[model samples]
Target: MYFSIEPKTSKEDLFNFDEPYAALKKCIGLNEERLVVVFGLRRTGKTSLMKVVYNELDMPKIYIDAREIFPLTPLSTNQYLVSIFIEFARKYDIIKAILEHVSAVEFVLRAEGKEREAILSSILKNINAEMQKRKTHLVIFIDEAQLLKPTGADRLLAYIYDNLKHIQIVVAGSEIGILEEFAGQNKNASLFGRAKKQITLNRLRPEQSFLFLKKGFAQAKKQISEKELMAAITEIDGIVGWLSMYGWHYLKIGSKKALETIVKDGSKIIADELEAFLSYRGEARRRYLIMLRTLSIREMRWNELKRTLELEEKKKINDSHISNYIEALVNYGFIEKEGINYKLADPLLKRGLDFVKI
Candidate 1:
């Protein structure tokens, strides 16, 4: 169904991504690249695209959601690695081999630090050998890969890309800059200077957004006025996640309640995300919030935003600091630059800023 909240597995339910879908399928099918990176802002359907391709592919595959292992610690990382090995072993009916390779299942679970990483590398090496013996490729999809940075999975990903030719890694992340950093798009990283297939998903245009809502409501067999649809489109804009949520809620409640609920629900969600982003920023957190809250009001040029921040602090702020702050926000997908002005990326973010304290 169009309004279903889960990541889409079927292409029939996906909308307006024909080019990307076809391109991704071809990229994975040809197996020309060791690494594929799918990049996009939040709610632009990166996960749905990944899931759909995963379902259609006719090869051995594994999908890992790194978000599940967040707040990464030695124990959690160890357990996650064991789980991956267990899944792979069960899929290939190689439980006996894995147990023999590790000597005991408990050792796999109890190992930590460098020992755990060595075990994971050994497991992948074994899987690669098995795939080579079978003469098949194993496609592994790691979603939200930016979260895996703390776990040092990038080194392992590099290892696979370098040595395990039969194992292909596809990673997707909503935080574009962070994902790139994790994937070695920057210098001095493990996978730097390697060939990679990159795909990006973007928000729908106004016309496309309207058509999406029209078709979605039609599929649901619900009646919604054109005027109401336009209002929802204006408020929600082009993000598919918000559009799907609004449609789902409209089917359950009425349009009025649905829109109200989206505001309440979306604001809290974005606020919580912003809070998480700020948690480790220390003194810079206040500056980020100020810049974000200011931009939430309206788009502003660099000088104007700096002036606003200065006024709020009643003191001078360095130009370099202002530049860094704007750059950080843009990298994190919170605000974007158009021409000389910077504005919040999502319409709902303005309302979300109201819920943020300071």
Candidate 2:
């Protein structure tokens, strides 16, 4: 009752939900040429933050989920060009204004499957012209941005980072390591040699979470003990999504022993989420995830991973195969490398992985 866990539609509600709002304001103020990459694990509420910022600002904004635009499969360059045009159509007179600047408007309209670099160049020029006239910066927030790699448009991102002077782009994805992979370690990589601002979304602290639950409980005219709050927070480890589900459970049960029920139900909920994530992945991914979980208990070196694999019941892992598995896992946001050591990307996911295994 009176809980705020849904997608935030307004500015005030979004800022008040969680995390520091002041820092967001500061980030928005820095509308430099460099694209700001805001990424975290799944369910970290990056989309909510973008929606809030867009609503607060008066500038014309366009938000798209890159997952929909760019899936796991490869897409033609023409298709990429079309998606950009389609997204711009949402804003009034935006597309029309762009088309007005180009002399070969019919050429862009008629282009089919594959096209020349010239057509793409013309489209970019018109769009850039429209962007300049508005003096109103465009914020393109791409959710699930890792989906774009298969399209080979990862370089297109570099193009935008280098050329788009008027638009302030913000790309968000669940996979931190993979997104960085697209950005590449090379100096020529777009956004390479440029300062990157990373914002990590961690779970709520126990005190803050308890305060939230207490406030909600008070509003519902129900009383809950400090012990109960502590117990619930400990079980969920202050994950907002899990905590919100627990609140929902408490509201339904309304029992003196709500804490125990909430913990039981919360574990099931977390397990269900893990199952959904794991279901889509393969055995190699699973093994990689388990390896990450093992490392999470304590940091593991490359040699240690090799030794652990060698001690396996039967098969020995090849270096290439191991590298590929590790890359896929890291790309999907399951495993992370700190120098030569590795760990799970999120501690909550680590706990869920550990719990689900048994």
Candidate 3:
């Protein structure tokens, strides 16, 4: 199931995390609760690792994907928490009895007046009390939590974490912008400085990447040529999500064009994120595209990047403008700083240079 291109929610598919798992076990140990945030770039196994930890922890849990509930089809905060409550009730037999009296959860889904807020809060408190009685932690996990809106959910979470000792809120976000701006280092955000622990997942090293592919293929009852697979790993760059996609394709066609799979199928997903990062810039899209393309080729100092953009735009770009762009790109995960130089985080993104223009 590690080779599954679709979502894999089981711990059995988890790999290379004896250290991270153990650390998380210590962080979220019995009654040692805090708001935990797991962050990383796309294709890293943030969700899978959380599931692995979830399986190990003996607690009542609900995993809500903000990507589904927030963007594209936005859900109000009431509806969001109500869904979590429903899932928790469904998972625990004891909560099913309380579910019958939870008319407010159903009513607040459509109506969000002050009265509704109080009603929903009371219900969450009631559920919290029941969880405490059972001596099991009430863990609510929100994946892609960057998509979560500023609906005072954090205030509610802060209230719960401070008062309801049995409740724990763990969120994971793949986009750096969402994670940082929403909860990390940002002083003004609700959960800022409140995350009990923060864990970042990085791409596997070369040897680990090889073993990951080998084991994933074995899990799927398929085989891959060692040479071709290594070449594919080079192309995929230790991104497990893309590897899963490539393996899914390899099983069908028996081909070794993992780079092709990444560029063709995965381009839009990456481009969409980049575009989302540059969404606020009105006339600077072309500059960003040219700069990203330039860095994709090689790392460049600030002066060099500014000169490249000047030549590309056929207009003078001030030093401050280019510096701001570089900083923003680095912060948003498109560009990484190496010493005093900057380069695209994923060189594979160069293949979609055209998409960046729009």
Per-prediction TM-score, please?
Answer: 0.94, 0.74, 0.85
| Per-residue C-alpha lDDT of model 1 across residues 73-177, encoded as one tens digit per residue | 656866786677778878787665556555544675676577777777777777878888888888999999988877777888899898999899899998888
Worst 10 residues of 1 by lDDT: 96-105
lDDT of 1: 0.85
Query: Candidate 1 at 115: error in angstroms?
Result: 2.7
Cα-based lDDT for every prediction? 0.85, 0.61, 0.73
Positional deviation of 278 in candidate 2, in angstroms? 6.6
Model with the higher TM-score, candidate 2 or 3 = 3
After superposing all C-alphas onto the true structure, candidate 1 shows an RMSD in angstroms of 1.8
Higher lDDT: candidate 1 or 2? 1
For candidate 2, the 10 contiguous residues with the lowest summed lDDT are 69-78
Model 3 residue 72 CA deviation (Å) reads: 7.3
Winner by TM-score between candidate 3 and candidate 1: 1
**Residue 344 C-alpha lDDT in model 1:** 91
Best by lDDT: 1
lDDT of 3 by residue, 1-358 (tens): 7777766566667677666666666766356556777877776888887777776677677777766654333236667677668667766866665665467666776665666667666767778788877876788777877666455556566677777777787888776765666664677776666646777788788898899889988887776689977888777677777877777778766774555766676777787778787788878877888889888778899899999988877889888898778877876677777798887776567765667765
